[model samples]
Target: MSNHEGTKGNLLAFLPLIVFVVLFIGSGMLTNDFSTMPLNVAILIASAIALLMNRKETFSKKVDVFTKSAGHPNIILMAVIFILAGAFAGVAKGMGAVESTVNLGLSLLPANLLMVGLFVIGCFISISMGTSMGTIVALAPIGVGIAGQTEIPVALAMATIVGGAMFGDNLSMISDTTIAAVRTQHTKMKDKFKVNFLIVLPAALITLVILGVLTRGNAVELAGDYPYDWVKILPYLGVLVAALAGTHVLVVLVGGTIFAGVIGLLDGSYQMSSLLQATAEGIMTMEDLAIVSILIGGIIGIIQYNGGIDYLLRMITRNIKSKKGAEFGIAGLVSAADIATANNTIAIIITGPLAKSIADEYGVDPRKSASLLDTFAGCWQGILPYGAQLLAAAGLAAISPVSIMLYSFYPVLMGICCVIAILIGYPKFKRTDDASASISK
Candidate 1:
């Protein structure tokens, strides 16, 4: 393909994504229920449209792109993580981990601290699980339960969980968003984590303070007599320890599942058949997201092959005149993609290469760009009604995703901090001594 052809994708190249989004909203509207709309079904329909585009290539060539991208090693690895994450959640929660963990935390905290405690718990779980969606699934119900026990609105409680989930989503070394950002930018994971932490810490602190102030002067007391097994909570703790120790994500999740299953069996929480069945059911539940991941990967590959992404980058960055502008450009690109796709890791993968090119072109630091990509993608993903995190949270809480957005303080705060970083350049990095170092314009 000629440079002109490669750099000037037709507007129609985006029809597939546009179609996907329209179908999602349209189905939700027609049914008067957003949660019932399936994203995977939309993707399947959109993929058919995507294949018809980029007609210059042979049919086999297009199929090759779709299949290859879907089966890309990273994509497959991401799928495995989802599987293990689901199994772990299923086995652990089935074995009484979720209830035990919630009880343990709530039983130890004052009423005013409930929201803050939930937020912190979400952060801890998300960091360990490396998935905001998983964290919300595991904790949003507990948040709703908390709301039932206190004067807090259910939406506020759910938002607290979302806020905390985004914290680890942005900072966790094992998170797919973080992994995609670092791998795409060729930056060290630890370096990206450090930069990400520096940028988000203030936002998190402010969120906690806000939670405290919002819930002050209230006391909640539970009337239930439920037992919390410290042993059941061990899987979460073990996952946390292993993740922080830099064990690979798959290892951590698989280990967690095994640990939970063993604990369940030894404690008689599950019969042999039930334990096996629970883990299988848990993994089955993740099919939607896992399939969406693969399909989105292929769709993104097709978009890139057709120069859709290149055209997008050129249009967005055309007027950039400084490093800060480039950073903002990166932020806007990823955030927009996140909103449209409703998935942060996929957004990162779609935008990462272009962000890298923009970073190099404008002398933006790789670590900073990686942080921006991961942070902004996560921020948008956390609050969008149609996004997986909010959808899962809203569904679990039996509330509207829009309602959850009302109190989506953490994501909004994180987004604001990201903008501030772009405007003022916090967490500045030193240039590499090597010749390839990017110096600000």
Candidate 2:
């Protein structure tokens, strides 16, 4: 069979991916707990399956393919970023940066704007912290309290928080989802952010308008004090500024961690000893994710070596006759993976290579492909009832995930805007030698 045609002989090449989905999702379905099956373990099992598939190749040769892919520079760099991001988040939260940031945003907004305030704050905190679960945990109780104090539905308040968290998860330079998308697509963070921000900005604004209408006439005399220290928030702001200025991601993360640690020490939030422990704890938190990325890389490497990627690409791009179709295909591919895994970052890591191949083959912009991968994955991950974001928010609010899903407007709108972006070819970029070339100029 010709390489372009991706003949039936390659069909079995997809079995490992299918097995992974079944092991992960199927176990979740049977146990009623997605967490029961760790992602890395599932990927490991699938990697084994992939290794055993191409029997014609010697076992040592197959191991080389797997190890080579796992050890690829991009994969290693992504793992390092994960480590740095974990440290920065841990240090910032340990030093009361999160509390102060949340308090500041809450204190500045009036009672009637509580819902909108939560949304905006969720966006800021998630973008800085780079985790939707963390943002939801930080804000869900407050959202429930707002719902109780006002006429707005509890589900609606929670939805706003989820939506805003997703908004940031898609655009944040520090977000794992964004990191995975950018690295996998070989696009710069700022370039992906520029593309992603334009697509999701309209969704955010429309969500604000919707929340405003819901919050109208729901004003309450807020009864609690929200104390904040301005100095503590500078780490988040500084990191954000540095990222926007296009500083190297490593420098941005390391600077943010150091800045947060210094602030914490100065404020007596923690001593040097405590800061060190916090950083260690933060890095520990990312161990699972780093391992998962490496395993997925190996699994993909083996799959690609066996022609699975070619088969999948052929199946996806078969009907595509234009760049728009290819963009939609990329979006659909990542969205499906997100749905299967219920994890956006993992979905990006899994689909990124194939998406890049599609982009290269179809002339779709890498920035746009990265944006679609993140945005669409965020879209699915945000609304999935079994997904961490809704489950965390629901558990915090003592409500069902479906309740929040009913009002989760931002993700739905984000998906719609992604479709519209493709249809209209919005946020056009130049095709040049440099993938990160300045598109604005």
- Best lDDT among the predictions, by candidate number: 1
Q: For candidate 2, what is the TM-score?
A: 0.64
Residue 178 displacement in candidate 1 (angstroms): 5.6
Point out where model 1 deviates above 4 Å: 1-4, 29-31, 124-159, 172-198, 209-220, 223-226, 322-324, 336-371, 384-407, 424-441
Candidate 2 lDDT over 1-441, as tens digits, reads: 122333532667668878887887688778876667776688788888978987778999889988998787766765676667678877888987777775665577776687877888889877876767556654665576567656778889889999988988788878888999989998899988888888889999999988888787877666788787889878877876776565666887799899999988988999999999999988886666667667666766776677764555566657877788889999988886676455688678878998898888998888999999999999998897656677556655656566688899899999999999999898867667876766642
Per-residue error for 344 in candidate 2, Å, reads 10
Lowest summed lDDT window (length 10), candidate 2: 1-10
Q: Where does the lowest 10-residue lDDT sum fall in candidate 1? A: 432-441
Per-residue alpha-carbon lDDT of model 1 for 1-441, expressed as tens digits?
122375665556678888877887777777877556667788898889889987678889888988887787866765665666678777987998878876776678878898988888888878876777657655664676667667899989989999998998889878888999999998888888877888888899999999999998666665665468899889878877776566676777788889989999999999999999999988886766678778876876676677766566667777888898999999988987776556688789888998999899998888899999999998998887656676556555657666788899989999998899888888666677753444342
- Against the unseen true structure, what C-alpha lDDT does each candidate score? 0.79, 0.78
Q: Scored by Cα lDDT, where does model 2 land?
A: 0.78
lDDT of 1 at 268: 96
